[model samples]
Structures are given as C-alpha cells and as structure tokens.
Target: MIGDSGAKSLSEGMTSMHELTHLDLSHNNIGHTGAERLSEVMRSMDGLMFLDLSLNKIGDNGAECLSEGMRSMHGLTHLDLSHINIEDSAAARLSDVMRSMDGLTHLDLSHNNIVDCGAKSLSEVMRSMHGLTHLDLSHNNIGDSGAKSLREGMRSMHGLTHLDISDNKIGDSGAESLSEVMRSMDGLTHLDLSHNNIGDSGA
Candidate 1:
C-alpha cells in the first residue's frame, strides 16, 4: 500500500483489469517506460477508484501516458502523484483530464516542481472539477499569481474541503488571495500553509 515492488505484483494479478479497484504505485521507479505499460493495463480497468503513484519517476512523458489512460477511468476518486516531477505541460494535460473527470474527489500533487504555469493550468481544472474535496499543491513554485488564479477558479467549486499549499514561496499577496478564497469557500475545513513565506498582513 506504500511501496512499489508490491504494486508490481498487483499489476500482474490484473489479468483483465476488471476487478482492480485501487492501485498504489508510489515510490516506484515507474518512469515513462513503466507508464507505457501501465497505460496499456489501465485501458481495461474502468473500475479503478484510488490510484497513488507518489514519489516516483513519472515525468511529463509518463504523466501524459497516464492521462491517456485516465480518459477511460471514470470511476477514479482519489489520485496521488506527489513528487512525480511533472512539468507544466504535463500538469496541463492532467489538468485537462481533471476538467472532464467528475468522479475525482481528491487530487494530490505535492512535492512536484509544477511552476506557476502549472498552477494556472490546475486552476483551469478547478473551474470544471465539481467533486474535488481535497487538493495538495505543496512544495511547488506557486507564487502570488498562481494563488490568485486558484482563488478565482475555486469561486465556483463547492466541494473542496482541504487545500494544501505548504512549502511554496507564497508571499503575503498569496496569503491574501487564499484568504479571499476562504471567504467564498465555506466547504474548506483544513488549509495547510506551513513553511511558506507569508506575513502577518495575510490575516
């Protein structure tokens, strides 16, 4: 449930990918090559719910392949890809997927190097995502503009409960942006802003 070697065995058990509901391939070395194989396997598994691929080497190319597979995964609820080293374009592709995937409730992208552009793309996704309850974007390069984008995009979102933006270089401006979001977001319960460079003026 936490590692990758065990996930490989589970992948092998997926003969037709029908009974598989959850798949956690986190901390694995499943780069582009492995993602290619995963895409093939996911084609038949339309019943997947929770998929965790955090701490892996799934870069932009691998993420793109995964997004291709995600088109068929209509049952996916939670998707974790923390520290997966995805670039802006890859995150944009994933954002496109999130735009249409209404079943996803939790999305984790912490520790990845998704920059401001990536955050912008995710903002686009947030506009269309109606079921997302938790979203993690910690340790990225999201700054004030990205924070503003998130706040603006989340205006229409009514399901978000938890928002994590820790370890980013967000300034007081970003904090104020999030405060604005908090004003409109009555559903948010847990908001993590630890390790950021926010000032007292944010409150």
Candidate 2:
C-alpha cells in the first residue's frame, strides 16, 4: 500500500536493508525519475529476490534504468512490472537484462500496452531462460503472429509450468499454434487463454 511515498524515501530506507529478500512497491506513483534513483540503490541489495513495481507510472525511460539495475541483481527470482507504461522498446531492453537473470522463475507484465513487437522481443530472450516457470502476459495486444513467435521461443523453456496470455486478441490460428506448443510442454500445468478469439475448432 506504499503508493505515493515518492522515491527519496525508498532510496533512503531500502538501501540500508541489505538482507532484504522481497520488496513490494505496487500502486506507487513513482515515475521515471524515481525509478531511476531507486534502481541505483537496488544494485547494492544482493539478497533481493522478489520485487513488485506494478501500477507505477514508469515508462520506457524508467524501464531502461531498471534494466540496468536488474543486470546486477543475479539473485532475483521473481519480478512484477504489471500495469506499468512499458512498451515494445522498453520490453526489449528488459529482455536483454533478463538474459542474465538465470535465476528468474516468475515474471508478470500484464495490463500494459505490449503488442506483437513487444511479445516478439520477449520471445527472443525467453528462449534462454530455462529456469522460468511462471509467466503472465495478459491484457496486451498480442495477436496470432506474436503467439506463433512465442510458441516457438517457449519451446526451450522446459521448466515453464504456468502461462497466461488471455485478453491478447489471439484468434483460432494463434490458439492452434499455442495448443500445439502446450502439448510439448510437459511441465506446464496452468494455462489461461480465456477472453481470446479462439473458436471451437482451435479450442
């Protein structure tokens, strides 16, 4: 519930907690400036494994700054950036950083404006994240092209067990492609493709 406490407070208080493992700053009004400053402090917290920055007003500038901070966070396992104003360019930058985060298992980027370009960028990097198990990309604009691309990229994620791509404008072709990929994912147990355009044949 620490929504509007600003970045100065976070930098001052969060930097001292070197042993902190999880930090949730969701619903905050923190923008690019605050995010940039907070990112600098987060680089020192080596024990940080989970971070939630959802509902922040962070855009591409903030996302790029955060990516820089995330590069040093090798121990990070779970990350949530949902409802942020991140787009395809920012997602690409984050994807580059994610390649180094081999420990990352869960990621949430829902409720944003990420479209086919963003999904394509994510798919390119997700191929190397073998430890990732849970991923949420719902409420975006990913279409059949993005779904097909993601299906191909996610084939390497053998550890992936949960996935959510609902409300992404996926049609029958996209669902067919995703279904085919799901059949090969032995670890996948949870999948959410509801609210899409898939027909009975694709279903």
Q: Tell me, by TM-score, which candidate is best.
A: 2
Question: Worst ten-residue run, lDDT, model 1?
Answer: 1-10
lDDT of 2 by residue, 117-186 (tens): 8888999988888899999999988999999989888888888899999998999998988888787789
**lDDT, candidates in the order shown:** 0.82, 0.88
Q: Which candidate is the best by lDDT?
A: 2
Q: Which ten residues in a row have the lowest lDDT in candidate 2?
A: 1-10
- Candidate 2: list runs displaced more than 4 Å: 1-5
Please list all clashing residue pairs in model 1, or write none if there are none: none
lDDT of 1 by residue, 79-100 (tens): 9989889988999998887766
Output candidate 2 Cα RMSD.
1.7
